[model samples]
Target chain A: MDEFYHLIDWALCLSGLIGLWFFFSRTGGPLNKAQAYMSVFREKGIYNPSYGLAIAFVYALLDIALSIVIYVWFYNDYWTDSDFGIAHLGRVILLYTIVLVSLHVFLPKIDNRHLRKTINTVDYHKMGLSMAAFVVVCVAVEYWLKRFVYGMWYGEESESILATVAVVASTAWIASSVYTSLNRYESIKNASERTLGALKTRHAPIVFLRSFVLDKPQRKGMTFDEYICSTFALNSQPIVSLSDPDDFLPTGGSIKIQSTDEEWESAINTLLMECRAVVIFEGKTVSLKTEMAKIQRFHIPHDKVFVATPPQNYRLAAWNDGKITERKYTLNYIWNDFVKALDTYGGMHGLPETDPGECMIFSFDKHWNCKAPVKKTGKDFLGYVVDQTVVHENDKCDYISLAEKLNRFELQHTQVLSKSDEKRIEKAIIKALIMSALMSLAVILLIKLLVK
Target chain B: MTPTDFQTIEESLGSLFFILVLIYYFTQLGRLRHRKKLDDTDGVKKVKKQMLWGIPVFIVLFFAMVLSSSLLL
Candidate 1:
């Protein structure tokens, strides 16, 4: 019993003495030395003291644990026989207190967040090597302290150690197995939900055209008027073409339909809501009644749709309350181009509303470049310059609509910057300075106490 | 035990320590490789940086022990 008390006292005394030595030694050493070493990797940046203290704590814990284990196994018997008392124990505890207090004060002020970030950007192999180095150093130091300064031994606990090793191995294996099983189950469940959701959203447009073949030919090849009528007959969608009554009227080519006033109103309303756009193919002479009336009924705004009505070269009388709508400019080639384009894309089986936006129109030309709007901004748009001047038809109007959608005001704002790094650096520097000063003070105090 | 015997024990212990460290290292490597998420480059760098200080301290202690018994005696 006496020997046991002696050993405890001796350990306490030795611990205190060592703690005092550590306090003094640090004061003489360079301050914020870790920050200097870290700076070599960075041009200029702050070092974080909290991060450094965390690392230091981990090392200290490992050191203390291994040292205690070694002492218990090898030095306990010898230690018991040594002569030590309460005064020694008190000194040891005091020394340790000062060291701890110093560390607490000094550890918060070093700044090195940028250096840490830079180091993190590197490859894994380099990182692994660095960690391995720390483990080696920690273990090696513990072994050395046990073998030399303490004259300790591992003793004959080989069997117990073997059992511990087995337990560790088994624990790791079990953890991995459980983790993998859980992950697989979660991923499979998520994938199933996604697939079901996608299926619910898929839809295809309804097609109404019926198949037919030309049977008997009356005049070998039908004239343009006859060709147009036959094509219209095959269209599945309900379409009514309004032609000029006075221009190029084939005497017997007129067709008639019978419908109630209510039916006509409902049809017009439905057409306005669903039909994307109308193609008004102009001719040599124009009758304004049926086409103009339909356009007004639909209330389809001018920008919402396009009229393939290229202005004629010659001035013609316009009837707005029976007077001519004053004419400004005329381009003959543009009118011919508009007529040709309408005949091509607007032939009879015009595509039903494919997407929500609008119906597209195009005309091919063998000569010079074509002008078309590429990007839309409200009323105006950026024109796509294909081959310096010729813009492709469908590609032109689509670009404008896309630009308008993208130009929403909220999307134009600049992004805010992050200040976490700067804040972190400032915190680290303050911590480091305080820690350094506290440690220095503690070390000076301890040295003074020891000599006394 | 005689100084010679102490040396033998120390040498054996040192070798055992080395072997233990090597095994632990290999185990860590296996763990990192087998991890579901691959090793993060930043984590590796951080570990390496810590080791720089940790390893040298360990090496000093290890060599000091080996020398203490034989030379200090």
Candidate 2:
């Protein structure tokens, strides 16, 4: 019986880990999954409070049924002989059902309000710390209730400490998972809002055209579009793209413009004229090729178009004939094939001879001459410029310098804030800090009093 | 060593392991921030992979420790 219990516990732990991995593997992770669920609910017009309550009640019943099955299958004999019996199990299940129902009914409403307020920004680290503090308070309360109210100590000191540790670890994991999802959802929503705002204001948003494969999450669990959005958040121009019809939930990178197959060409042509810049990531797709043709046909100013190439000579391992074989490929090789397809288009330049192991962005002059490849330098500041006059073996300029150069070309202008505007922002930030500190103090005080 | 002594050592090791896991979590968080600064996508990937394995291992070890302690008591 002990061995069976241990096996079941370990199995549960393993299954939980697998579930976590599965959730993380999704494009936007669990938050996007939740958003997709909410989207569906909204589409059916069943996103209201009454529907939420009904759904939660149904789910709670299902959960209780599953619990009963597990209990009957595994613990029927053991629990019957022990202090904990069927009645105890039933009581526990009933309590859990109530808690689960409450969570399902209320969590979305709380999350929606939280997202609305923190749409532009959310400090995930702060959220995690806050959750940890909340868990600590709950642990303290549990300890107090056991010792004073019930007048009984835990079975052993080591057991109590271990239980606390387990609780803290689980709570930390849950908090981090929730905050990560919230942050991703918030970023996507904010990007979409900004994109629409830019279009309405005629801000000439940056149009992103790339192969759908690039939308896949990389090792860092970030899509290429998400990376671009993060990298250029300060650029004052929105990054927008035509929505992938296949994507059920909008991935939070560029603002996705929904259009059918028939409308794609017209949309691209419109974007070409309206966009401040068109950035295309290196990919080999018929749709991408067609888009490139449209760019050429429109004769969009050469300086306004940019090509982003991934790191060269990236290695990938493949299992062949019961042996692992590694192969290396460069984006320049792919770029050459793409250039070949557009034989008559002279505006775009061919990739450089050298393969810079880092991702590089290239632009052309108004006269269709290939300018120097731009890569993000290790340095953060603009002053770390290497002399472009000296021809380096690996020719590249800093991405910051390239942005500044583009600014010079008046492709997109950065807004300068006035002294009054700066002061107003500073005052608002100070006020927010004081309010947050006071709120934290109040929460601590409340927890202390409750524990007492 | 006697059985009690062995149990004492095991409990101490379990406590030490718990503390070490906590430290590991903090260090991983720091490493993630550093990776973000460098825009080191590959490094970020490595850290995430470590975390995925690290978390499950910690949970398993923790459960084993708890089970042993509970049985001893």
Candidate 3:
């Protein structure tokens, strides 16, 4: 026991000496440059492989020395001749391993982005297993120290309980640490993505699907409802419906369908003055190409006049020049292609470019119930259009953007909300308070349980 | 060992854990300053994660040690 104390004293002295040496060396010379490089490496989120590895090595040695001191200090002060022998140390080690293993298994599953990054795949599995192994090794070493270096804890009951307490407390600390880390990671990740995504989306174009009627519906033509639905589906717009023309139609707009070619031509002229784009759907009896050619005599650009026909499956050569097979019509694929074609003319800024650093984002928040408006730079406007659907179809609330919601949050400082909004925020706060209270109670109970 | 012995151990451990926590917080402060200097967020999450784990562990251990000593007494 005396010899162990001397060893620990020597180890501590050595650590202090090294620390002091580094402090002075780095404060006044070439070592400062090395430190600056290390700091840069850390800042870039790059693991200074050599430095981290070195730190880990030093930590391992320091930890072992500390553990030996802990064991020796406990043995000399408390455990004499009793049942609390090396075997008791083994049980304590096992308990520590169990708790660590539980954290390893559970912490990663909590689903927080900050925590996820910190506990990356390699770290998660490796650290958990290594910790368990470390516990076992610590126990073995404690046992060896007690058995050979000092004949202690052969039958000490009090020391046994004390040992148990130490192990239990340490394990509890580790588990709690994991939980806390996971939560912090989540909040940080969410805040960062929300801020950046909002900034990016702010400058992007606001795209709206505009529809105008062409030749007034002939008696054989599809109803406005069916036509609009099919067109929207063909265009692959995220908008699900505009079935109620009352909801979308421009106020004071007149509607009339011409049955004759003479009436249709006049209707087309009138509709052209009133709207931006017109759709002409020709029934199977009409030759769409002939009618389209006549319209083109007016010399409108071909891109604005979108034409659709019934699909027919046929064989075509594959890209690899292998045998071709008949393929079915896919509205999803066709609409994507249509969007691509529109992008070429509108300048392809209509698609969301994949952001490498930005993480999975929920476009709306529960509290604000608002969708985020898209922001984009002029470069983004030239390059890609980001389109996002904020609210789920099944959700009852209307979409609100994050920027708008942030504005709403700011509003709370001034005027009071409506009775219903007040009630909603109040309910949320109450729920949060209740959850926090419950968690506190659970933690208290767990501490009590683990102590026993 | 008497209850007081356990109490002493608990108190010392509490202080030790606090010291460890303080060390960690100082390290984090340095890191945050460095990070803010560079205007970056990359891998900051990892450091935050470690602090999250480390800070609470000290707190829990401090209380646990106190409670265990009382129970033992």
Candidate 4:
């Protein structure tokens, strides 16, 4: 037994010494796996800082666990077996404070530009003080929790390792896991809010129309007032004739809901929010040149707009010093062009049928689950005859208003991740942390009580 | 067995447990790198491969130490 003990002890002692050598050197050696593992985390450090901090916290905590195990192993070798002094525990914790801070702070700061940006040259002392405070706290936990616990357990003639198992497994893992979860939760919340904000502030759609359309025949042969009723109704979509105050208003036009010349731009802004399609009749007396420019400025997608203008002798393109160029076409002309576009577009894509306007029926999630049972049939969402992401496919419902509350401040009428989604993720993170704590507790108990 | 022996065996087993975890985590990292087609950082690729090989060897060695200590009369 003495010979075997000496043999195995010599081997472990040699390997441990080598591992220490490799670790301190930070060379391409056995410790490279550790370095590689860290670099993987470092790669993600910039774009998602909170997630990166979570990784760092986890890695530091795990390293400390491994260090504790190694410390216990070495205690018997360096000191009298299992009769370690408080000074030795202090020394070990002091070493961890140095090593963990180096890895977590200094190492990241050295190479990562993102980490470097955290400190201005002038604020180095302040940052240094904060970092020192953090390290002091970490070392205190390592020292007090392990050393003091070991003292009590040792007094009962229990092994010193029992204390380490308790501290490293239960206390350390739980604290680190909870911290990581909170960091990730804050990150996701901020990210979700930023995305939703961008969506809300976006410019809405606009439709251009001629005043003649309100008073003229509804369609090619129908005579109803276009405002009260229209011909060739597309799923009963109203041909809302949005007008400018500058346009020549023939009598009997629909401006019972009208604005004056001073409020014309404001009126267009209002229409930009609500108008779906514009049908401008290209006659001798009407034009929507400013409204067209506003539509261009808002970046309204072409599919949302259709223009109708009379055929001209020759198309003209604007030019200035080889830089300025634009094709001048009336909204009415664009309407005819849009029909051509629909033909070419539908021939290749088989779409425009599934186009979502102001609202939708069943949401993407619901549509997916409902359609996926047939498996491959619903791959093309447009091909599905039913409109999704709404209640009962009601376009008139103004689903955005009646939409489910996403969080305290907003509603989700579309497929973008809502605050509720973020909350669900946060809850999952908490559940995972709790499960990890429970598992760590179980293992700590098993290890500490196993000797009995 | 002496308390000293228990301590030695426990240390070996504890080290084995930690190493097992490291191996599992490193394996996950390796899988992640491959899945994401990640480029290797300085010395990481070589060390990762070496560690992958070295861990199992260490695992076996630690297991032997624990088993032999546990069986000693």
DockQ of each: 0.01, 0.03, 0.01, 0.03
Model 1 CA deviation exceeding 4 Å by range: A1-54, A57-78, A81-120, A147-149, A154-452, B1-73
In terms of TM-score, which candidate is strongest? Answer: 2
Write the candidate numbers in order of decreasing TM-score.
Answer: 2, 4, 1, 3
| Model 4 TM-score (2 dp) | 0.24
Candidate 2 ranges with C-alpha deviation above 4 Å = A1-64, A76-168, A179-205, A212-240, A245-256, A274-276, A310-349, A352-358, A365-372, A377-452, B1-73
Every model: iRMSD: 36.9, 13.0, 21.5, 22.2
Greater TM-score among 1 and 4 belongs to 4
Fnat by candidate, in order:
0.00, 0.00, 0.00, 0.00
Indicate which candidate wins on lDDT.
2
Docking class of 2: incorrect
Model 4 is docked with a DockQ of: 0.03
Identify the superior model by lDDT, candidate 1 or candidate 2.
Answer: 2
Candidate 3, residue A383: CA error in Å?
A: 30
Candidate 3 Cα outliers beyond 4 Å, as residue runs: A1-58, A62-124, A143-156, A168-452, B1-73
lDDT of 1 by residue, A425-452 (tens): 4464455445544554454456445644
For model 2 the local lDDT of residue B22 reads: 61
Q: Positional deviation of A181 in candidate 1, in angstroms?
A: 21
- Cα lDDT of candidate 3 equals 0.33
Q: Per-residue alpha-carbon lDDT of model 2 for A1-452, expressed as tens digits?
A: 34544655565566556545543444222223334334433443323222222333333334334434433443433333233333333433343334333333333221111112113344444543544354345445544543444333356898668866765675456446545533454445444343352232324456788766567443244555565455544333446676654342356656665555555677677666666677776665678888888887888777667666543222111101111111122233345555554333434655554433355666677666567777752221111111221122122223333223232222121122346644553353244334433443344346335634
Docking class of 4: incorrect
